[model samples]
Target: MSVDTATKPHDRLAEALAEDMGRVNTMIRERMASEHAPRIPEVTAHLVEAGGKRLRPMLTLGAARMCGYDGPYHVHLAATVEFIHTATLLHDDVVDESQQRRERPTANLLWDNTSSVLVGDYLFARSFQLMTETGSIRVLRILSNAAATIAEGEVLQLTAARDLATTEETYLKIVRGKTAALFSAAMEVGGVIAGQDDARVQAMFDYGDALGIAFQMVDDILDYAGSDATGKNIGDDFRERKLTLPVIKAVAKADAEERAFWQRTIEKGKQDDGDLGTALALLDKHAAIDATRAEAVAWADRAKAALAGLPDHPIRGMLIDLADYVVARLR
Candidate 1:
């Protein structure tokens, strides 16, 4: 399974799904518009045009295509997925007080929290409108549940952030809620809309679930080790006092004094000038970064394995590559 180091996997997927993705993008722009609330489009466009990979929506399109769907509803479903994703991002930026997203100033930063939240709500409503147009009850159920789960996950992360006592198990629940729920739903609805068999649909769900967890873990790892090209400054998680996987692993192996250090910086939010350096040193000493990376690779492997039961399509190959690319960033 040699990857062509020349072009990235996502680029390959985009190339393969160009027409479908084009429709999804068009629908996104059309739905995000509102004549009455002009500010909605402004705020939504600011984040939507911020060079996102559109991976979640692409997952929906790829899965539908792989399952032999030739209908137009897949486009609607893909747009639904993107709208849901954008909505979550808007709410998340406000919740996290994040200043930047996708290397651009967050909507909350450019406009205000009220605009961000309202626009996020508008997107959620638009997503439901698109979902209903498909006339699939199961699709609606799955996506609505995912939206709820995302909010629940956000709440869980809000409560769990900077808590030294947060276990990996709890961390996973939060991840599943906030991130993996949408990915799984996005994939599942694709198969469901395609009238795929139960086994194949379940495989789609599993692949999306595993891929989402791996994706979030990779992001967490990048917060510690990645360059600015990642759209994040290194140690942003540390400064934000987030209890991501690497930090959680490091805490698990911490000595008493190290535990006190985490309690002060992470829990109490009293980071000194040298605390980040010390935290990085401790993470290295405990191999937390490596351990977190191993878990991400494991999840990526699970995602690839879940695809074993699916049809042998070229999109399938891109999917395997996509799963590989999820963890290859660690290299």
Candidate 2:
């Protein structure tokens, strides 16, 4: 397959892995079904079909193919990764009380919190069933551990919310748990299934770990930068009083007056009119956005560097391009 320069890296990857992705999608649809409860399918279908980038599952398929895995289990694993991701999003909407996701009404909003939470639970069960089918205990262990880490991360974030005392290290720990764990597991499982050596598998894990951190950092940046394309309203994170990296960085450098502003708006949740603008101004004053972008670029670089140990395949180039595309928005 040939890709044009005009095509985005992920689009190029989708083109390259078209057949595998088709199988993964088919498996996702088939596995998301419910025999007894009709609402299960209904709630799951809403978010599953909401036109997400499917980046996590794509990482699974891309890694497996890059490692020359010809088995059908990669499809199963890809679907499993996506199911876990969708499940988290379902629960997240409920926790955040978010009405919208991927520019569509959230399952919690469209149905109710009960339906969304139950459906998310069902997906988690379904993901476990799918992983077990792979008959690779290693895959199951990796995914199960990732599932636990994701939950742990969410809990940590909950406790640290709007605290102002949340450190960059704490922020990184949250990022690794909530986002990077699955990414590393997804890629590592692919290499494991392909019987790759320990070193190569670790490299795949390293790539995904870095990529996930960069992805979340970019998301935090967009929440403040106001990207029409990302469907992120400027200051959504600010409105929620979430202590994302940019805000954390600014707080680190803030003086008494700036600290008081963050305390009132974020800690006290006493946001009033024009607070968003003031917050943006503070971020600019401290160059927080630039610092955040620098961190994202560094992670993207680490992601690309990790791929150096992988096989010389077309997928490798595509994966490298994907990492570059992830941080290109910040540039």
Candidate 3:
């Protein structure tokens, strides 16, 4: 996608890091290419070419550059982050049995589950190879641990996501695994590559962690009341029977009859006509969307705050504004 001249922080960040992003994109393309297995590149390009902000990997580049690293390995790390993200997306589409992604047919729909899963594994392996090129033991440890955490988060969601008994604590753990784990890892590894002190690296991790939480919270709220874009299509989560924070809060405040409603729609997966509308009404009645939005804002604020203890580069200001822009979707 063309970068808009509009002053969106991400777009501006892209403009600022255009040269580095070019290198990262080149690395991604080169690494995704398989010399023998043509299918690998096809599947990888389908998703990679799909339009996304590349925000997570950009965060890695941003972190490294802000810390004054001019090495070529940042490109490798950024590619590693993108490959990991793409791998998870492939697996997630299979798990969700999704028909569409980024407004196109999902790989699972076009190919098969076996293809999607194996291609995702190939990407994961590619990510590890890219990470090794960095040659920092700490970088290896941080990313490897993040990969484990990300897988763990997905498994926990498998069991806990449908269980109405899932608490805020459990939801938080799941978010850290599936979403924030990568974000945090991306940032931490960026700092590590720059050889920043432990304190700075920890702050980098905190920024990514908070930003990711806010990002997911906004997504959860969007599922309840979103469009095809900003908000998800209305009630996709309901149809999936996924117990996100909004519905979880609604369930918490449910009366006996409301409990039966949740049990029927969510726990039993016995949704009928008007069930989605009913879920929306319940969420509104409980002000769950409002509460979730508030929490998202809080996390976004925390993300901006984390940057305060670090660099004073213009990119740091962009990161702060990026946090605000994420939560601004709620507005």
Kindly list the per-residue Cα lDDT of model 2 for residues 1-331, writing each as its tens digit: 2435557899889889899999999899999888899878888887899878889999999999999999999999999999999999989978887523433664446567778789999999999999999899999999999999999999999899879999999999999999999999999999999989999999999999999999999999999986656666788888777899999999999999999999999998888899999999999999999999999999999999999866589999999999999998665
lDDT scores in order: 0.90, 0.91, 0.88
lDDT sort, best first: 2, 1, 3
Give the distance in Å from residue 203's predicted Cα in candidate 1 to where it truly belongs. Answer: 0.1
Give me candidate 2's TM-score against the actual structure.
0.94
| RMSD in order of candidates | 3.4, 3.4, 3.2
Residue pairs clashing, model 3? 226-231
After superposition, the stretches of candidate 2 with alpha carbons farther than 4 Å from their true spots are 1-6, 98-111
Residues 111-212, model 1: lDDT tens digits? 677777888999999999999999999999999999999989988998898799999999999999989999999999989999998999999999999999
- In model 2, what is the error at residue 159, expressed in angstroms? 0.3
How much is 72 displaced in model 2, in angstroms? 0.4
The local lDDT score (0 to 100) that residue 248 gets in candidate 1 is 93
Clashes of each: 0, 0, 1
